[model samples]
Target: MGELVDFFVRSRNFILFVLLEVLCFYFIINTSNYWGATYFNTSNRYAAQVLAWSNAANQYANLRQVNADLALENQRLNARLTQLLQSKPAAPAEYQADSAFADRFKFVVAKVVNNTTQFANNYITIDKGTDDGIRPGMGVISPTGVVGKVKICNRRFSVITSILHSEYLVSSQLVKAREIGTAKWDGVDPHLIKLNDISLTKPVSKGDSVVTSDRNSTFPPGILVGRVRTIGVQPNRVFHDLTLDLATNFSSLSFVYVVENRLQAEQDQLEKQVETEK
Candidate 1:
């Protein structure tokens, strides 16, 4: 207490000067209209700036929740689009079957809990499983494009065979040429995938957009897979050597939607029965 008193005594002159300056400013602003208006305008501007900064900080803090909500909304939109694409206008005899397929797809939004892009066989793990209606062979996709297929599932989690996997295949098509081919990774580049079975005589070109083909059982038809980055001929191969720029960047994948095809089991069983008979 004594030391505080001594310190205040030593700085008394400076403190008095500060008080006098504040008093002078107060009197100048109160007595002069121009000074008061200028002071209030400057203060208001500073106050507004401070409030803006505060609001921005709040928004930044809530960004994760905002992203999750947006993903869920997109899941619904994507599900509806897939249903529409699969359901075409049918004749009266087939109207019931078409109507059944109109709502046969369901999309579940799941957070990517794990991902790998550096390996020859990359995989992704999501925070959903059989309990969430996820199943092996279900298709997974990001907001921008194709992701992978579900390989395994538990009650609350599922592992996906990413499109970067060496053995996984996606049925893809060139939008302009309408050529269907199998898209596969060569264990080389994560950004590029190889599309096979496109004839060299066909009008293949760079910058052509590639998308999931309608013959696929996994993803709905027409989901973007990649764009053609190069088209060339291999030395002894029968098909054109085409590379595509993948739409989904696996390195930064945060969320995905698992697509459930309600009729896939029946389709698979029918195909298996035909194969067995052969």
Candidate 2:
């Protein structure tokens, strides 16, 4: 108390000067129309700027929540779409009867927590795992196109073998020519991949769209793979060399969906039985 009083006494003149200065400026601004207008304009401008910054900060903080909501909404829409596609009438008489087709795939939305595009064997990590129903061999895709396949999973996270990986192969088909082929990364460019086994006889050309083949058990048929960027044929070669621009930009991937085929286990078992007999 004594120290504060002593300090105040020493600073009294300075305090008084500041207080009088403030009062004089206030009275002058209030009395003068031009000054008053200038003061209010300056103050309002500063206030508006402050409010804008505050609002921006608030929005930035809410982005994660907004993204999560969007993911859930997308999941709902995908489920509804799957149901509608499967509900189509098979035959005129069977239209009234129970639909033979049931929803075979379930989609789970997940955020990409980690990704790599530069490596020969790239991988992605998502914030979902066995607890979230993610499993090995499940196909992964973004809103734009296919991303990868789930490779490993635990309780709360799963790793995906990215489509950019050199060894990754996806069954693909050319849209216009209906030519079936295998899509694989050449380990040279992250933006491009090669589609092999397409016969030179097929009407493949630049700008042709390629998509997932119907024969794929993991990925849904007709999902976009990429567009043909270059096509070349070697002498006496049966197949044409195709370079494609990948649909999904792996470098910018954020959100992806893990696809679960409900009948995958059954299909695997049947295939295994057939293989064993052969």
lDDT values of the candidates? 0.90, 0.88
Q: How many backbone clashes does candidate 1 have?
A: 0
Report the C-alpha lDDT of model 2 over 108-194, residue by residue, as the tens digit.
999999999889999999999999888999999887788989999999999999999988999999999988999999999999999
**Prediction 1 global C-alpha lDDT:** 0.90
RMSD of each: 2.4, 3.4
Give the Cα-based TM-score of candidate 2 against the true structure.
0.82
Those runs of model 1 whose alpha carbons end farther than 4 Å from true positions after fitting are 1-6, 89-97
Model 2 RMSD, rounded to 1 decimal? 3.4
Measured by TM-score, the strongest candidate is 1
Model 1: per-residue lDDT, tens digit, 150-194? 999999999999999999999999999988999999999899899
